[model samples]
Target: MKNILVLCTGNSCRSQIAHGYINHFLKGRNVAVYSAGIETHGINPGAAAIMKEDGISIDHHTSNHVDEYSHINFDYIITVCDHANENCPYIPSKNALRLHHNFYDPSKLEGTEDEKHTAFLKAREEIKAYFKDFVSEYFRG
Candidate 1:
C-alpha cells in the first residue's frame, strides 16, 4: 500500500482538508492518507464543518506532529503551506516525492462569520481540485 502524508504548519486546516479529499478519492485503492504538522494544532472546526458540507468527515483526525509519523515510509510527502515546506524535518523515506502548495489559511482569516465560511469553502475547493489531479496522476490504478 502506498502512503501519503500532507504536511502543514499546523495540521488543522489545509492539510486536513487535503487529507479528507485524498482519502475520499482513493478509497479502496490500497493507499493510506495521513496528515501532520510541523507543530501540533488541533483540528479546525471550520475545516471539518466545510468538509462535512461536502459529505466528508474529518472530525476524527487529530493534530499530529510530523515526528509522530517519522517511522512510516511515505510514498509522497505533500506540504500544504510554505511554513511547513520550508521548515520540514528530514524524513527518511526511500524516494518519497515531495510536493508543495501554499493554500490560504482560512483559520487565520479575521472577518465576519460569513467571510470565514467563504474562505473555508474556497480553500476546500482548491484543495479538492489539486488532490483530485494528484490522485489521477499518481495513483490511477
Candidate 2:
C-alpha cells in the first residue's frame, strides 16, 4: 500500500482539500490518503464549501495535528505549506519523501465574502490539478 500524508501548517485548507481529492480518486487502488498539521486549528469552512462545489464532501473533517499519526508509517510526507516542510518531525528512513507545495491561505484574504470564496475556489481547483498530475506520475498503475 502507498501511504501518503498531506501536511500543512493547519490541517484545515490545502491538506484537507488534497485529502478529499485523493480519497475520491484513488480509492481501492493501493493508495491511502490522510492529512495532518503542525497545529489542528479546526477545519476551514471555505475549503469545505469549495470542495462541495465539486461534489466532494470534506465538511466533516476535523483539524488534526501531526501527532495523530505518530504511530503509523508514511510512504510520502507531502507538505502543502512552507512551515510544515520545514518543521516536520520523526521522518522514517525507508519511506520518507518530502515535497514542498506552497499554497496561499484563501481564508486569509481581506475582501468581500464573494471575493474570498473566489480565492478559495481558485486554490481548490489548482490544488486538484497539480495533485492529479502528481498522482498520475507517482501512483498510477
Candidate 3:
C-alpha cells in the first residue's frame, strides 16, 4: 500500500476536500490518503457541507498538524495551497514524491452565503478533477 499526504495551511478546506476525493477514488485500492496542515485550524464547516453535497462525507475528518504523522512514510506529499507549499516543514520521507497545486481557498472567500457556496463548489470540482486524474494515472492498474 502507498501512503499519500495532502497538505494545506489550515487542513480545514482544500486539503480536507482533496483527502475526501482521494479516498473516495482510491476505495478498495492500495492507497491510503491522509491530510494535515502547517497548523490545525479546525475542520471548516463549509468544506464538510460542500463535500456532503457531492455524496462524500468529510464531517468526521479532523484537522491535524503535519507533525502528527511524523512516524509514517509517505509515498506522496501533496500541497494543496501555496501557503502550505511555501511553509511546509521538512518531512523525513526520503523517497516521497512532493507535488504542489495551488487550489482556490474557499475559506478566504467572504460575502453572501451563495457566493461562499459557489467558491466552495469551485474548489471542490477542481480538487475532484485533479485527484481523479491523479489516481487514474498513478494508482490505477
Q: What lDDT does each candidate get?
A: 0.94, 0.86, 0.94
**Lowest summed lDDT over 10 consecutive residues: which window, candidate 1?**
132-141
Structural similarity to truth (TM-score) of each candidate: 0.98, 0.93, 0.98
111-140 in candidate 2: lDDT tens per residue?
A: 999899899988998899978988888885
**What is the clash count of model 1?**
0
lDDT of 3 at 116: 97
In the range 67-113, model 3's lDDT, one tens digit per residue, is 99999899999999999999999999979999999998889988999
- Determine which window of 10 residues in candidate 2 has minimal summed lDDT: 90-99
Off by over 4 Å in 1: none
How does residue 129 of candidate 1 score in lDDT? 96
Global lDDT of model 1: 0.94
Q: Give every collision pair in model 3.
A: none
- Give me the overall lDDT of model 2: 0.86
- Predictions: Cα RMSD each: 0.6, 1.3, 0.7
Candidate 3: worst-modelled 10 consecutive residues by lDDT: 132-141
